[model samples]
Target: MRKGKWGKALGVLGGSWGAPPELCPALTAVFQSLVYHECHFTNGTERVRYVLRYIYNRQQYVMFDSDVGEYVGFTPYGERNAKRWNSNPGWMEYKRTAVDRFCRCWYKTFTPFLTERRVPPSVSISLVPSSSQPGPGRLLCSVLDFYPAPIQVRWFQGQQELSEHVVATEVVPNGDWSYQLLVLLETPPGAGSPTAARWSTPRGPPEMPPDAARSKMLTGIGGFVLGSLFLALGLGFYLRKKVRGGAGGRVPPGPERLPRQPGLSGLLGVTTHANTNVVDGRKAFIILSHGFK
Candidate 1:
């Protein structure tokens, strides 16, 4: 069971996800008791939770508790609240008396009925692509399924801690009896630089190197280009060979031969007329059939 401030977004809790029907009246009473306060409540078989926050003009006070009515956590206004509360003896005395009385009463009535249990967490880490950087990328460390809230997570490089380019989400309840948190780390562009995530819980030891990932991507592209070049060369060679073979096998026509006459042959001092044809780098000739004149 748990409760927290939802501000103006309280309307979101009006449907099935809202507080249990049995606890609405008690929560409404707590809200109306103060001029300006927001209240949320959750009740389960094992535990009951309540969170009350008071806001007047600008002053604020946040208080939370589980099972028992005694405040497990409390914060009043800000640094100014400490100074102002201490300045007045009567107000300081009243505040102390009220807290002691509330603790004593709640513990006596409810502590005996509380249960003892522990829930272990589930953690997952992954690398996600980021548009903020052209290469390299971002890492997401997700911690989930833990019981009793509040866990610590940190980023590291070898033994050195990484403080910059990191973003963390607040602890959020998982509807079930667990909580979750998300921590993001931005990897700087570099070759073979390793990044690690360390968590207080016993679940994480995830490491990723930006250089190795980049190298793999480049290797795949290089293989594709080399293969394409070989394929193109093979196709061109086959086409050239086919054309040469066709040219070498073709036959050229023989040149026309003129008829020989007996009188003409004597005048020309020739016994035969010849015509030549060239094919496949060899020459041939046709000789006229005529006797010497």
Candidate 2:
């Protein structure tokens, strides 16, 4: 096989692919040979790693790691191949320049495209219901529907970051180029007002402010309380009117006959029950029930 040049650099790996198949007559089996490049982005842009690798039968055969700047072999056959390939001046020069020629050059070209494809995760936070830890609330922070899975989710109380009690889920692939994750923050925030702590994500939008969230919750509670107060006042007025009307029309507990007030009872949404005692020669007071019609 004629050795060409050691050149070319990455896409994703993020994306990984192999070379053409080679037939091995000694074993009467076809062993596939593969070649691909990988770009690893780290915390520092200066620390990005570019690698050109070769494979045989799905095992690593040889590689030109940018950090190492040479060919490395993982197997005996690969060692012989690497030694022969590394001996050439053209191979060395190509390997050395591949970082600048392809890695950095294409890296700059493709970075904006990657950035354009970046999908920010949607986040929501809720207090985790725990019968055991009811005193200090546990928060379940749901981070959902995102792309380019690498992300960091954190908890913060005002400007201070809370690291001790934070918990997170593995970046779960949603099977359609999207991802989901669930992070949990334990206690601390629950010790004070609902606005005592907040959540944050460096790669995502700023966490919902604790104060804003508290305000929304308080607004809902206030509306509920106001509605209940109005309902109670209306019910009180209705009952007061019914009582006054019944008292004025009712016959006293004397020897007078008890007249049925079915029309008034139906109108008042009440079920009326009364009894007259022959032995005592007195009429029992009427009983009104809202439960039964």
Candidate 3:
């Protein structure tokens, strides 16, 4: 049925659409309507529901319900409209054919993805000051970024489950097909309250997807750092022992402390004076730089 006919009929009923009889008559009136559909896919079968709501000058006037299969009125003006429209057999047949022509076709064409996507939820528990609430402090548990709408949440104080003065919100849509939920526990303000939250799905909560990957990366980095530190320490000890090589493991002397050999200082034409003498074909020399010996 055309909406223009419905609006014009309500206009002739004389402005009693939830307004008083003494209400002023206007030369122009605003009429609006909302048409919406609910399509469902269940067990491989599709179902559809169609609704149409009318608003006359900002007041709710009438609506057409699929369950009733006809128009239902809200105001006096809309009641007269429903009676007139239901009497017409031609118009009533059009409304009956809407299930196949409008709602069923809409369900088949648009609602192929009735099944919701699932994602694991992340949870956090915090103790926050609450001036507006009855308790001295509130333990707030937020379950974020989950899908499929339905989830389970709980609050715990050590091994005990808490229930009193608990406030929880309905699942809030994040507009990107995910949902969030908040649960808060009321407690007396104090330190050292070990509160926690458990967020689970119907099947049980999976491990956090991002945190699992991050933990692996952090563990590998820690192992690499420890291995490098031990390798550097081992190399340092090996070099120190090589540099101090001798009979008693002493560092070698500098050039100014050398005792003159028979063919070395004269062949290079460089002379170093050290107390030396030959005794029974063995050279005896004095040490110079570190200490005289």
Top candidate when judged by TM-score against the true structure: 2
Can you list the residue pairs that collide in candidate 2? 12-15, 19-34
Residue pairs clashing in model 1 are 192-211
Each model's TM-score, in the order given?
0.32, 0.43, 0.39
lDDT by residue (tens digit), candidate 1, 163-268: 9888999999988778998988776423333445555532233222333334555666666666666666666766676788743322222222222222222221
lDDT (C-alpha) at residue 160 in model 1: 75
Pick the lDDT winner: 2
Candidate 3's residue-wise lDDT over 106-197, tens digit each?
A: 66665444342345555555557878866445666667776668776665554476677788999999998788998876664233443445
Q: What is the lDDT of residue 181 in candidate 1?
A: 88
Per-candidate clash tally? 1, 2, 0
lDDT of each: 0.47, 0.56, 0.55
Which residue runs of candidate 1 sit more than 4 Å off their true CA positions?
A: 1-116, 188-190, 201-293
Q: After superposition, how far is residue 209 of candidate 1 from its true place, in Å?
A: 19
RMSD of 3: 27.4
Candidate 3 off by > 4 Å: 1-49, 60-62, 72-84, 87-90, 105-115, 124-141, 148-150, 156-175, 182-196, 201-293
